[model samples]
Target chain A: MREEKPGPLWLRLYALTVYLFLYTPIVVLVLFSFNDSRRNSSWEGFTTRWYVTLWHNELLMRALLNSLKVACLATFLSTVLGTMAALALSRYPFRGREAVGALAYLPMMVPEIVMGIALLTFFIKVGIQLSIVTVILAHVAFSVGYVTVTVRTRLAGMKGNLEEAAADLGATPWQTFWLVTFPRILPGIMSGALLAFTLSFDDFVITFFTAGIGATTLPLKIYSMLKFGVTPEVNAISTIMLGFTIGLLALWSRLESDPKSLGR
Target chain B: MKRFLAWALVLPFVLYNLTFVIFPLFTVLYQSMFTIDAEYNVSQQASLDNFKAAFSAANLEVMWRSARYALTTTAACLLLGYPLAYFIAVYGGRLRSQLLILVVLPFWTSYLIRTFAWTTLLQKEGVINAVLLKLHLISQPLQMLNTDFSVILGLTYGFLPFATLPIYVSLENQDRSLVEAAADLGATPVQAFWKVVFPLSLPGVISASLITFVPAMGDFVSAEILGSPETQMIGNLIQQQFLALFNWPMGSALSLVLMLLMVTSMALYMGLAGERDA
Candidate 1:
């Protein structure tokens, strides 16, 4: 390998500027969360009052709980279904395989608004109420694609010999899966679950359409708060949500180190 | 038996998607063909009225504005993201993963919060104005919020990572010897980049453009938060029709139009890119 040459000074400066631009909003959001004043125009003395208020705000708290509930359920369902689909695709060469793959990918390709309203219309037509159940269904539908992609990638990378060797040692199929296959794909499944949870937790547009009265999630609550106007309480909640998402992503990166996987 | 088991394993996923994804989209298409009455009851009779209304002058203006904003956002993201991606791929040796993480970190956060952060910055008495005023740069605060500029800026900011990561992947995967070979052939650095580096990254550029453009086209959050009613996009229009106006049929028609446009543009872009490769 050749020794890497340094980039031009101008290029370095330009990259730095882009980084600053990317981070400034996040930094500002975090900073003003602790500001004493209600207005975000200027920084006042530091205070944790907004955080305190956020803790006591019943609607916001309910929304947070609802987000967690929806994310957990959606993540579990999508992960299982996606992993199964990935396994079936990788393990068997069946007719209509390509069609099933395309069907799985359809949710990701369609715009969120299209899917949101379509689901809304479908639910109303089917006589199903718009509630957290609908939100979970929508999330699982969208997230199945991500999980399938991730697990399929992992399956593609695995050596088929390992599972064969396990079976050759007098192990049953279920035993081979449990002792050999499951462990290898666990990281992929976990990462997919993490991705699903984050997507569900932070979703706004889909949740906005699917959520009925009293079924607000954090993003929906944040949207309403944002529409109401700027406040330090909103900043505090946003900061917490940001922290949670970053923490999840950090965990995900540890499981799936390749940045390319994120693109899929 | 194994094939049957595989089919069984895949059944739930297939059923879920058929029930939720495919069926609902078909429902949207079906619903788009019908009409609604003044009492918000969808009529049994199917007609093309919703499609016509979707193409009305006012609706077309919103669609055109959406396309223009999406295009502009795509262009801006390319301009800003390409260089940063290029820098990271070429110059970032040890810190490459860290830098990539920074690029994606903001993306992982809730987009609503990120746009709201911009509201705090771009408001009339917001941080930017306060700083500018403090420095005596301007006599009065510029009306930065609730404008075309803010909405577009917000879109670009929200989608920059989408543009960057793909471009970076393409650049990183390129064989360095190609550039070296170009250099050895007595080509200037600029010539080498344009002829070798940039051409090789076309796939990434195309992917970046599609991902960014499609989302930006469908995005209403930035416009809803940062733009006024005058600057609303097709997304906001669809949202209003369903949620505010109680016109599900119109919303369905508008959504189909948006999807049709996206598919058509994607096909056109891929066709052009394929021709270029050929």
Candidate 2:
């Protein structure tokens, strides 16, 4: 007997069509990245020359490295701060708890342009020069909310029994968390860190306002390249970036699903 | 012990938010009110002159265009995204996570690159037109680029995943028995959906609208690459003021207005959502 499911065959076709629409432009870009000639719309033939050219582009490479550096620092700082905030929110009841929670969640709500300009104004008012440090600070500022939300969900799913049992066994509060609580929420922390890293890596608008002349990131570089004309070199760089993002997301989803990694 | 531990852990982030997010927003308001000359001389009293100029006929038209484009794009996303989200949540079975990830993969790519790809796909002599020509559908290529159509298309394409994810979450969490109960009571499939599924999934739709509209209203990338000058949005105007024209007061004023518009809409949505969820 055919399974008369609520979701029908028509739904599947519709879903696949939507997926095709979403993926086609990316496939086009990846295809043209290897074109033997410099036409964006035509396939002259296959060649890896664009990849080689991209490899040799010093300015873009520097930008790529800067993105990595910022992502790493921002991810680390945000994970630590956000994890602490999450632990606090879940562990205690206090006055103005709702207010604090709302305040912490504001970054997730505000538009990027607004957030970008607000920080830009703050930096200029305080006379702090824009540079790589400023970029990292801005990235961390916005990304902490992402981390807190992720970690808070993890902490919510957990039982207080484990930590209480640890304390009942004469373990110190710090030791109990380090041994029992921390390990259980580690997956959430890792996922949050991964999210922050990816967000910082691909950031353009916020960086546009906060970054100085010498501290351009990869997206900023690509934006400038688009100004001249779309070229195969940009295509090659985009392909590599697309691959990197996919790999990271795969790792993140893996951590998310595995209970053992979540200290089961 | 627990209360002390909690506050200690939370205080640093609160401080950081105040210094970074809150203070800067206040500065935007302050910056909007003052006029500065060539030598950086500051005006003492607050003035609405900057706001007045920003709301002048020319700039107000751009703001109106931006909001209208955002609304159209949000509607397009909902029309296209809701069905896909329903399909994935209902029929994806073991493939649910995989398919959801597919929706997110495009979102993970660089925004600039994503927009750049559309230029190739939609340009006058681009792939779509080339294919159409080869198919003998049209003699001349369609002028797809440098138009509002292309801008809306790019914005929708780039943002479909944002629309899908929230709706998918709500759909996935819904009790299937509600729909089944409706079906068992002699309701048609379309009736079951309209009466049961759509009402249940509305919170997701509301959130999807919030995220989509906020970013779409502030987007300049789609405008700069896909739209002509006549269709340029307030974002482009703000960018011009800050970057090209060096008119800081006007730019700040414009930013605050956009921010106010976004906040009002968000608050309205939240108030409605709170009542519904309650």
Best by TM-score: 1
Ten contiguous residues minimizing lDDT sum, candidate 2 chain B = B35-44
Name the runs in model 1 displaced over 4 angstroms. Answer: A258-264
Error of 2 at B5 (Å): 1.8
Tens digits of per-residue lDDT for model 2, A1-264: 335455677887888899999999999999989999886878899999999998899999999999999999999999998999988888788776777778768987777777787788789889999899999999999999899888888888888998889989999998998988988888899999999888888888889889987899999999899888778888899889888888888888888888466564
Please report, as a value between 0 and 1, the fraction of native contacts recovered by candidate 2: 0.76
Which lDDT value does model 2 have at A261? 64
Tens digits of lDDT, candidate 1, A1-264: 778777999999999999999999999989999998988878789999999898889999999999999999999999999999999888888878898888778888899999999999999999999888999999998999889988888888877798889888989989988888887788888888999999999999888889988889999998888867989999999999999999999889988985344332
In candidate 2, position A35 carries an lDDT of 90
Model 1 CAPRI rating: medium
- Residue pairs with backbone atoms closer than 3 Å in model 2 (clashes): none
RMSD of each: 2.5, 2.3
Per-residue C-alpha lDDT of model 1 across residues B30-142, encoded as one tens digit per residue:
98998888987878889999998899999999999999999999999999999999999999999998998899888978998999899888999888998999999999999
For candidate 2, give the lDDT of residue A102.
Answer: 84
